[model samples]
Target: MGKPAPRSFAPSPFRVYNPPMSDANPLTRRESEILDLLAEGLSNDEIAYQLGISPNTVKVHVRNIFEKMEVQSRTEATMEALRRGWIRVPGIEAPQVEASAEPLSWPPLESGWRSWQLLVLLAVFVGVSLFVFWPYRSISVKVAGAPAFTTDSGSAVGVVTPRQDAPRWSQRAAMPTARSRAGGAQIDGRLYVVGEIATGDTAALEMYDPNLDVWQRLPERPVAARGVGAAAVDGKLYAAGGCAGESAITNVDRYNPGAQMWSSVAPLPEARCGLALVALDGRLYALGGWDGGDVTDTLFIFNPEQDRWEEGRRLPEPRAFLGGVSFLGQIYALGGHDGVKQRSEVWVYDPADDAWTPAPSLPESRSGVAAAAEGVSIYAIGGGQGEQPPLHERFDTLTRTWSTIDSPRTGPWRHAVAVVIGPNLYVVGGWGGDYLANNEAYQASHLLFLPLGAQGLQ
Candidate 1:
């Protein structure tokens, strides 16, 4: 009868097909095979090749496997499979799917679909709640406070609270030597105090660690000096022009902390003290300072790679002891004395075009202030009227406006040095009338100043 219908190889209808059921009781037999292969770290192509199936078929199987396992990623799927005893190794035996003896059926499609819908709805609900309920958050900071200035009609010298939060001045740590009117530079995170007026003609190099709240003595300068301008390029700290003993110095010295040694490098174009040295755009810019006698308008840039100094655009208003900082790619020269008068003038120098532009002036005219750039704001702290004003001002670069911060705990004076470590600013070694070695750190709420939001909300 037509070759007996070609004797089909299909199993008899009475023969039973028994497939392994997972303890989690959801995945189908084929889906379990696909997941097991996935757990073996085989990609779709490799899985398809091993299974003798098309990559498209593997993809469809993978999607179905994910839905059945309720996992988004392969790692999650593998983890779930292992957790639920859905997989077993060659040597290891598979755990029993269920303690109950009844044969399990696949979970209802409607139930799985409903669970997925519930998850999506929950996610959407949480996201909407977060967006609607938590739009903006408020944070308080301790900043140097605004000074209370009492002007003397002709030439007013006012007492300013130097430390913002506290009424009484507190010392943080003492420097190895008493220093005043020093050059300070921060490299990496270490605060380096280069040259300052100490007991003797001091060349003492002191380093302050903010993390430890301690000071360590570094190798002394090659020549005992003060008023030396320091800047870091790459990893090397360059100490430039200052006075050695009582004489003005042009000699530039380089310090290697790793080696704990010092070496002399190329000298500055002019011997200067009270000048500003800052590293901007990979080059060190040395701004206005005193050249033994007169205040200099001389601006020079040093290239560490070439070990040379090139003339830069000079400050429009010549002044020594000016606070200079590089912010938003521009060098800002703030409050300083021009020999005859204390200046509130703020000037910005752009290296790209080599031009100087006047910025919004400081609220108070003071020189020898400690200027530090934190984010987009520059803080002019504890500067004197000419020598030191008991004044503190903060310049917001974004707003181009100046706001007076609360005064420091110490009296109004300058020659104090400030360096920003993390979110806190440390003011150290300032002079009020006589040279002071006291150190103070502002941390509490009283020292913080919060800026207004776009909507004028604090």
Candidate 2:
């Protein structure tokens, strides 16, 4: 073979383009230069001119400097650099300063022009931070094309939004009375509230008409009770199992809104106070409560059609002063006291299978909280820590995780009750030591949670 033909020079497929290396560390060169310029009190424009670069480029470099230094602002950057041996005062002769240089000046850059630029950049940063870190707040919501009645601090507050200089709704109506430990149910567009007080139990039953913004007292409960468990089924409000005369009672009553009358129903198998009741499918399920003196583990199911009560699977652990809500056809029981200790354990009951399963645990142990389901999520609102600590917690049923919420309006009470109408959740009736009548409502500030494969609206 006449001397194998010289192979033509071919670039290797695996070779990557390699740029020419500069004398200094390219990753940090721009940052170092920017810091030096900043220490010399040179304006970005002046620094740009001295470095023969665009002011925008200088800005990018300064930003990199700030980030690499893990600082918030130019002042913070300077302080950090001085502390980290990255920069120094002129007279100090530090390792970073190789030659004599003027002392660094305040604000770093020229007064009028550079100050404006810095201010503009700062304003931009602040705006971005606000948009990123600020807590989202729900503005307005409508259900069935009508504004729902929302309660705040035991008062009826309406949503007010200006439309063409006209006030949409800006009036506050008085609540019947401050109620804590109260249970509420909505029937035929009317909201009914029952029982909640530590002492001098209230048989007072009140109904609210959202369209008229008026509250009227309905027929009083047949038996005076507090911490009562309640549910609405077939247009009738069922009140059952509450504390009466310093003892838990199994007295159950049903109220007919159309007739404005009350009738006794089959009492729950167990007398419980601070129990949670939810209407699911056509039956009512009662879970978690104090029976006489201690928390009970029994779960009771009431069939309104049959006028009977049946025992369902018991809770994994006995708990009382708890909060429960029906979400995605399942009953979720959140934090509550287990008689001897506070618990963060959350349990879910599936009626379809008649079984109880463990779900996510709460971030903190608490009891006497209130819960309500809106859309696909259940929110556990303010409650006392165990039989003590006054704090508030919230949980997303879809995500099965607990998060602390900013609840400046959380009352000192522990056994509060909650109900959801539209996008608002109202917490009512609780007791710290004394009976708390404070009624507070919280608006879901984030998007309504929709669980994966959820079939119903959340």
Candidate 3:
């Protein structure tokens, strides 16, 4: 490799992304385990005792974590770990760890008073352990098709049911204005519906609060478009390549959920509609869609570091009105249409090799199916050919096989969107018979599941 070109702009110091880290700087499993502890506000001695190791040994692991994560202090390491999904802080919001001129102490405490305090804390923990049940969120698993959880076509689940089948797809509060063909994705803990609404629907950005089972409206996207693609990365939602009136457009709109604001980024090279998008390795990939005149196979990738788009391998077949989801670190383009006919081909793209591979075809030729990945499996939700169905299928990456799962109650639909957050796979607005404002959730049964803030233990 040669010296890289100099940068035109500098990103913020707090920025973290999914760029491939160099293999030359790697951390062992033990080091990653220690970093997880550190993110929980554990000190060196506390981590050492928890893992049945010496304080000095834990200190060595912490040093290695700093070097590999390229962070000089514990706070930086924790934030980086969280951004990278290497660690998760459950039950509580992430603590604000501000930057300081001086790094923190190794164990963070010293001398006799702290030592006696630790001993007293240990005794209290033992007593509490015996009398109170620990949080079971960590050990529970989701059960598919639990009768205990149910939702109607247009109604939302107002209560949380504690049963053997914990994870399920229950309808949430319907959108105030039911519309379809809109772009949707989950950013932060809320689900955002963007893009084109039904002909008379005034609101462009609609948000759903799953916990409260209520709907609230947000500001519309910067650009007015239909047939756009949506994916959330770096905590920002990017809506790219949809139709602007009769012409296909290359315009891109970015919205920050935190600031409730909109901005622009580099647009796609080709102005296209009915595109599919997925976020992998902290980057965005825009796949096949329809130009104003014809369907296209071109693929463009967005690099956040440079805010630029680089063209990649073309799709094996030109597709539009398709669905896509990233599973096991690769993008899978599901069934789609070529202007006139629906397709069953399963095309997978490997970012590492920059190549496309054909996987098993859909059980049946279908288009406009919504997809979401959980663990190693990707579920193709309700979609079909000329006459759509309520049926969806599951594809397992590990086995390279496909199986038909019970269809969602959403019935036949097209242009729907699905996103995975925690254990629930949230499915939102699409054209089901007519434009829909419904939001439904799906979760795998008999699978290990851990949701944020789950209380009580088995």
Models 1 onward score TM values of: 0.59, 0.57, 0.60
lDDT (CA) per prediction: 0.65, 0.63, 0.66
lDDT of 3 by residue, 1-458 (tens): 33223212112112122223542326677787676555433345345545766656987888777878898776577656655645533322334456688876546456445877889977975555323322211112111231101001121111111112223556565565445456777877778877754332122787777777776667788777767788889888888877665567898878888888888899898887778878888899999987877888989999977999999999999988777988777899998877668799999999999999999988888767788887667888766542356556788777888987654453455667777766677877665544455667766543445469552121
Best by TM-score: 3
lDDT of 1: 0.65
List, residue by residue over 1-458, the lDDT tens digit for candidate 2: 12222212112111111122531223365667667545433345445545766656977888777666666655455445655545533233333333347865456576455867889977976565345322111111111211111111122111111112111112223344445567778787666888843223568788766556566767889987767888899999999877664577898899999899999989989788878888998889989787776678989999998999999999999887677888878898888778777788889999999999998887778776777777656677666542344555556666766666555332344566667654456555454433343345566534344368553343
Cα-based lDDT at residue 64, candidate 1: 83
How would you order the candidates by TM-score, starting with the best? 3, 1, 2
Those runs of model 3 whose alpha carbons end farther than 4 Å from true positions after fitting are 1-168, 200-203, 445-458
Q: In model 2, what are the clashing residue pairs, if there are any?
A: 179-429, 180-429, 180-430, 181-429, 181-430, 375-458, 376-458
Better of 2 and 3 by lDDT: 3
When summed lDDT is taken over every stretch of 10 residues in candidate 3, the lowest stretch is 146-155
Best of the two (1, 2) by TM-score:
1
Tens-digit lDDT string for candidate 1 (1-458) = 11111111112111111234533467666666677655543445445545656656977888887787678766577556655656533323443565577867767758666777779967975565335322110001111121111111112212223334553334576554445567777777878887654232457788888777677778878876656677777777788877554456788888888888999878888887777888897998999877766777989998888989999888897777788888879898988777776788999999998999999988877777688877667888877653344777677778988876656554656767787765566778755533445567644223334566322111
